[model samples]
Target: MSPTRHGWITTPLTAGLIRGALDLERTERGLLPHRLPARARAQCADPQLHMAESQPSGVRLVFRSRATAVELDTLATKRVYVGAPPRPDGVYDLLVDGRPAGRACVTGGATLTIDMATGTVEHRPGPVATVRFTGLPAEAKDVEIWLPHNETTELVALRTDAPVEPVPDQGRTVWLHHGSSISHGSDAASPTTTWPALAASLGGVELINLGLGGSALLDPFTARALRDTPADLISVKLGINLVNTDLMRLRAFGPAVHGFLDTVREGHPGTPLLVVSPILCPIHEDTPGPSAPDLGALSAGRLRFRAAGDPAERAYGKLTLGVIREELARIVRERAAEDPHLYHLDGRDLYGEADFAELPLPDDLHPDAAAHRRIGERFAALAFAPGGPFANGSG
Candidate 1:
């Protein structure tokens, strides 16, 4: 039964073969990965968070094998807007012994279409598809298949020409990161190219990305999850999602930030923790958000975003990017005296005005693919370089 099809050996998907997900779900079709555990998921029934947490931003399948070919069967759920252009197919990247080896995209899967204006959704089911990678060296090697960061996927099946085994621990430093859609690889080309993934590669560390799209709103459970997860280094990128969602005012945000950090500290008080502020977002910098899709652009078959909140709302303590950054810096500064390991990194250093001019965010919010690469490289240089906050053994 194991070698039923040709000489391909079908290996059952298991937790040890995967990385970067907190939970594995036994779905009707296959194994679905969830960033948040079921306990945390039950606390909030928000559909957006449900979708984001299942997108597998930093999730990958890692194993040791001597196979020359591998094939994976997956069932993916892709999102579509009623009026906008069709989203590109999600990319699956193959890495052989820690290097880019091959890439392919799944063809058929379910589609969920949403009408932004009407708040309507239509679900159209599709078929399961296989993503195959061949032409590998016929020698023992570590194999990794990075899943798509922008689509929901279920691991249906795994097959290889040779038997596979769990990869031995490499003793690499573990780096955990949290943020909004940008960190979730919203506009990134592939999984490994996501800024956090790229940064992890450059820093030579293992990555645990908790970058939930539009859902990084300083949830207590998320922080608790971060608190409990094991890692040698940790960084939480805050501000973008909060501003865009208009989740709270300054009065509440300050306490929420503190509470989030407090929960994480409860678990790893000595871990080299980094608190990063919002990056340069022009629309939300001086103005408050509730960002909304640009209806005019939508009519023209383009997807764009615009700030919906009034700038004058700042008088009411409504949070803006500029306000949040200042507050984050001050909070870190005040807390650092008592907690020596706490640190803050201005998000602007990752993407500033000059970088914006050169590579503007295509949707007036999320960075484009090129910007993702630039941000990733810059983060690696600043955070992992000598004398940096995440520099060698700072933890």
Candidate 2:
């Protein structure tokens, strides 16, 4: 929990607070800045690269793309490390669609801390603060989040959102989405252009994206996280991550899903929850799926392989979306008798034959920007529009 300007103790941050702070400071009135090279001073030529508040409460800067891209979502276990420190008295602003979404403040101030030798700016009296922007435009496409004070303050560690984004208003709805790398927006053009973002735009609902890149294995923590977060509409896109990770066998898969949903039900109770299985992938379609990697690609420093060994050496390794869908549908139907809101939607509904042919994924793993829009548009039409196909049945 970052400190408030008024010295109030808020557990988590509200978006409104974030906006107010950036505006108070009038940080975003100028052009974007660029980040300098590792050998040069922290300040650079590009507008986005320089530290500036896009809004009074939100700050942003173009991070040194050449250095390292910061990881956004992660479990509580890992620690974040920054190459250089931020300038003293600097404030970081978060921007949504080139506007403010949030900001971070450097505290325990110590200036003149640039490391000429290592090109790392280490500030004294650590503990930087963050404030997030709320009442955001539902149509927001991308979020421009910046860490201010690059010359003196280094963001070495971070904590996850404590309580998570809140539930929608009394009359409004919440959208909960889960998926793998595509859902996590790996190769997507920009943050706002993700399919989930597009869908949220069309649906006019709050979003909680639980899409982890290579980590969605029906883990118990993820289930608990979903179960605990508040929501009005929920959807989980399963299968691909499971297939790619090769985490469990068919025998264990069914029980794991049932248990995961059971956890979600604890908090949502009767809220609508949709389970979406994988979309079509030719590599794993007809043949037995590979739990291990194609080592030929890995040795080149390109593709990553999680599991070990070649296909011939493995005895138990196939887990298909077709298999999971059947099992998941059964679970939903079984539970629907007791919980009417339980539902299942096949992933093909988002991207089937026609759409796939029109906007094919680049690497055959994730969808492109055009596909993202298509998926989001299709999702909105099918799931959110009143009396649509996947809506609450009037019958």
Candidate 3:
């Protein structure tokens, strides 16, 4: 059939064309993608988790279409820390037939400005913006629109010159992963370039990322979500968020890890499950946290994080990166005796002391774009290579 120049066809955004997110909520304006399902969201009242899950990290719209032009209408909620430099506009990455093709950005959207010192928040609503891509090959092809990883986007409409249909699964192994903001693409360039996305590309697997920024606190709801989601391989990067939030003591951490893994095993008894500790965060390695923003640096137009807890507090069981690494390794070792499919990867193996010496974390916390690339490549080789835990035919 020849391409038509008729009016744009509007398709309802549904699960068939969306990947990574666990649920979609119907809003007055459009569909909102959420990392956590409605059941999980209803159980938690933390504003942090609510905001993080809505950011759509590693989420994308995938379909087969012959459209020469596509336009997406979206309402984005972008965060801005008071006194910090304005963040660059979020990019929409377009992939056609499994190759990078084009990129575009939305102009206007709502803004949430937060005062770090006072814990005050102000919201400013902006109009919906349209992101359009043109001159796509006028033939049926697999298409993907990778949503912004950092901004909370409500997809209002999808308009194409030709009708779009969900792409059929290609029989690739599904890799479901959960972690903190680092896994959520904090300093990465774009959605598809996030470490997990990059690693997924290299490992040739379909990724469903549950990387909730600042919200990976071993929450029961998250573990339940993981248990219910189907996957050939699973990983949960633990520690940083728990320490930073100061949410639990060392005593609570052990049982939480076991409970999270137990719930997941109930559903995926034989699946390869990897437990990853946090990468080196210099500020929080020996020192425990409630990590606080470095107000001195922020005033000088730089953003940096600092650990507030004293090292002496370790005597009292405060958690730190060093302590977390030991605990995670011990847990995985003990569990592997009974569950052979279980494995542990010290995150430092992905970005260790030497790498840190050369490419130090720019903000004393999150890795820069370069570090993300290095970690992604290393993870692909370590976990997905032959004889490794996630090897293609190992199961």
What TM-score does each of the candidates earn? 0.98, 0.57, 0.97
Considering summed lDDT, which 10 consecutive residues are worst modelled in model 1? 386-395
lDDT of 3 by residue, 182-235 (tens): 999989988888899999988988888999889999999999999999899999
- The C-alpha lDDT values of all candidates are 0.92, 0.51, 0.91
lDDT of 3 at 131: 94
Pitting candidate 2 against candidate 3, the one with the higher lDDT is 3
**Model 1 stretches with alpha carbons more than 4 Å out:** none
lDDT tens string, model 1, 1-395? 18848888999999989999999999887899999988899999998999999999999999999999999999999999977888999999999999999999988899989898787888899899999999999999999999999999999999999999999786778998999999999899999999999999988889999999999999999998899898889999999999899999999999999999999999998988999998899999989999999988999999999999999999999999999999999999999999988889999999999999999999999998899999999998988889788897432
Candidate 2 C-alpha lDDT tens digits along 1-395: 45333442223223322211211112122122211112221222432122221211112222111111122211111111232222234344545544444544434432334333243554344333433344444331444444331222222322222212232234545676767766755444444556776676667765556565655678665676677666677788888877775667777888889898888888888778888777765554433444444345444433333333244423454566566667777887887888877777777888876777887655556676788777778778877779653365211
Candidate 3 — number of clashing residue pairs? 0
Model 3 spans with C-alpha error above 4 angstroms: 1-6, 393-395
